[model samples]
Every structure is written in structure tokens, then in C-alpha cells.
Target: MTRDIRQAAAKANSPEYMSLWAGQGLRLANDQPAASTVKQTIDEASIFVQRFLTMRNS
Candidate 1:
């Protein structure tokens, strides 16, 4: 195997690999349906936009 592949495989097999590499945001992510995730993201953006517009208008 190539050096990069060997290093990746070794990292994948290590116990500390995920804990050392994964960010705090990783815990908030889920294996949900793509469409559902997209909808939720859009809904969150909509709420933020609404609040921003309201603030600008006031």
C-alpha cells in the first residue's frame, strides 16, 4: 500500500484517532435523511433571516 493509505488505515484502527480528530460539532451531526437535513437547515436559516429583517426594520 502507499504511504498515505497506510497512514490512514493505521489512524482508522487507532483508539484515540476519533477522539483526537473529531470536533465538538461532530456530536451534533446525525445520520439522517438528506432531504430532512436540508429542510432543517433551510428552516433554521429562515428563522435567522426573519429575525435579521425584523431587527433591520425596527
Candidate 2:
């Protein structure tokens, strides 16, 4: 049970995984205008940082 819980938490926290997910999101959002591109990049980067911090904390 403890191992299962840990696995769940790790899945929730993995930065590399999250970055891929966010990158996909950015790609989808790319159809929007240029002004939105900066926001999307920043949002994706923020997700990357959050994932990094989560991994670091673990």
C-alpha cells in the first residue's frame, strides 16, 4: 500500500512527464495569435518549474 501511494505521488510529480504534457498543450495553443504565444510559453515554463520543484522536494 505504501509503495502504491508512493507511485501515485511520483506520477503526480514527475517533471519530465509534465514537460511533455505542457509542450503538447503549447503546440495546440500555437494556432492562437503571436501575442498569446508568450503567455503560453510562460505557462508551459511555469509547469516545468513546478514539476522540477516537486521532483526536487521528493
Candidate 3:
């Protein structure tokens, strides 16, 4: 809704950010754990981006 959130959504949709998120998945797949803070931030970012897209579409 806010400009900051919309900006984050755009950044999250970028290829570099997508690759970074995907890398986290690969780390998990390999049984490597990301730092707690990194994991939490990424998880929250993912949720925000998903919800942002949903709201945008509606």
C-alpha cells in the first residue's frame, strides 16, 4: 500500500533478489542453515512480497 512496501515488492521481483532467495533454498536443501537473522529477514521479505503481489492483483 505504501510507497516503501511497493518499492520493496519491485526489488524483490528483480533477478538478483530472486537469485539470492533461491540460494537460501539451496542452502536449506544442503542442510546448511542460514544465520537466524538472515533467515528471518528473508522469510519475512518473501511473505511481504507474496502478499504485496496478491494485493496488487486484486
- Please tell me which predicted candidate would have the highest TM-score against the true structure: 1
Q: Tens digits of per-residue lDDT for model 2 on 1-58?
A: 3666656667889543232344455655436788788887899999999999999999
Candidate 1 global lDDT: 0.80
Local accuracy by lDDT, each model: 0.80, 0.71, 0.69
What is the per-residue lDDT of model 1 for residues 1-58, given as tens digits with 9 covering 90 to 100? 3666657767789543333566789988899999999999999999999999999999
Residue-by-residue lDDT tens digits, candidate 3, 1-58: 3566556767788443232345456555544467876887899999999999999999
TM-score, each model?
0.57, 0.45, 0.42
The TM-score obtained by model 3 is 0.42
Displacement of residue 53 (Cα, Å) in model 3 is 0.1
Candidate 3, superposed: residue stretches over 4 Å from native: 1-34
- Name the TM-score of candidate 2: 0.45
Q: Which ten residues in a row have the lowest lDDT in candidate 2?
A: 15-24
Which residue pairs in model 1 clash with each other?
none
Comparing 1 and 3 on lDDT, the stronger one: 1
By TM-score rank, best first, the candidates go 1, 2, 3
The collision pairs in model 2 are none
| Residue 19 accuracy (lDDT) in model 1 | 35
